[model samples]
Target: MALVNDRFSKWATGFSGCDGGDIGSPHSKSIWYCGIEWGGGHPDDEHELINKVLSNDVEFPSEGYTSDDSPPGWLYNLAYRFNWQAMKLLTAVSGDSITSYKVFAEKVKPFTKGEKGYFKMNLYPLAFVNTSHDLWKNGFAKATGLDTKKDYHDWIKANRFPIMKTWMDTYSPKLIICVGKSYLPEFSLAFFGEELTFESEIIDDRELSWAVNKNGTIMVVLPFLGNRNGLNKNVSIQKFGDRIRELLTTL
Candidate 1:
């Protein structure tokens, strides 16, 4: 069963609207990494309780959002597919070799909360087992005043997108990596304040979409890193990361 307490309640209060804060540094030059949403919000899964609690506890105290180091079942654990692959991509993009696990453990440092060079967050605030799941309907309805996921999404598009734009204006990040090419509109509107036209190229038969704005922030849309159709293969992810690095140099 989903665990709810004072902490969850307090977190939901701020998280229910356009003010849902991010999970990493607010550094002006940080690389902003935007995901679809926080995963694993199923009310029935006991495994997600720790994730829920820790997510609530995350804070950005003028430095960056701080998170505890990987606990065994934590979502940030390197054992998790998403976390691992994300690290690999970041490592590769940094022009480092990804063949060694030490790239994450030593060099790139995945999920070290409050990281200065990286900023992590989601377009939507509420968590889910997957994007399509509506199990959070009841929980979010009470906190956000919109029940159906569709309504909440619409509300976020209207309200939250502007706040995101303000953040982009304020921080001026060097790179914005948005996962899920399907949410291109959301990412474009949120970060660039307009619909961005992406140039697509097929690498190893997997499509990689990217765009560069006049302000020097490059936006890239990649398939989900952990999903079935995601860039899970080492070769494909490495190639994509290299392409992103190449794009970064032009700016």
Candidate 2:
């Protein structure tokens, strides 16, 4: 089957928090990584992340992760995974270059905890959304605890799209970048209220396509953002930054 047909096991999303001097630019200091639901959707009790609203002393999964009951294939690194490449893209556009993810994480610490920004890109709440495909996989390690949260799941079914729209509208970042493009159609449905008809344009290494909604939020779909402990080699952060900026200029 095609990559699009495969179910993604990774799912994460966030909004940055830093006053963007250049607010109008697509390369604005803010960027978003639409999470991954790794592990072929094993132990996938994914929720809308009400945990964020409940108590957020630390980020998600980092707080919820417990390996004792987790499935055999469960990769521990999935917890608290940040998109360093996404951060690099932010640094590239902002001119406030960061050398590593460690540096970027440190800088965003205050803001992630809800430090007010005068013109901040606000990365707090680290909003996460599980693709509908995150579930529906045939596997031995099916999800648990889903029975108790039918109401929450109901809310997710009804409000997930609107809530996502709210997040997008509130941040209003020039560019809305997603980690993987396999599920691009689902993303289009969420943002634009219909499936997108798209044609890819090859930009040196990767083929990219753009979908601009009525408000002009350019959704740039690409592969997994960067290395997860030296895996997911298909994603080249350096190449992405180079080609993305160039592509943005053409339109």
For every model shown, what is its TM-score relative to the native structure? 0.78, 0.50
- In angstroms, what RMSD does candidate 2 have relative to the true structure? 10.6
Worst 10 residues of 2 by lDDT: 1-10
Q: Show where candidate 1 strays beyond 4 Å.
A: 1-28, 42-77, 110-114
In the range 82-114, model 2's lDDT, one tens digit per residue, is 434455554443344445434544454211323
**lDDT (Cα, 0-100) at 102 in candidate 2:** 48
lDDT of each: 0.65, 0.41
Highest TM-score: which candidate?
A: 1
- Candidate of highest lDDT: 1
The sequence of per-residue lDDT tens digits that candidate 1 reaches over residues 18-103 is 21223333354777777888776635333354355325543321232234334422234365676677777887888876676454
* Model 1 CA lDDT for position 56: 55
Reference-based lDDT, residue 154, model 2: 39
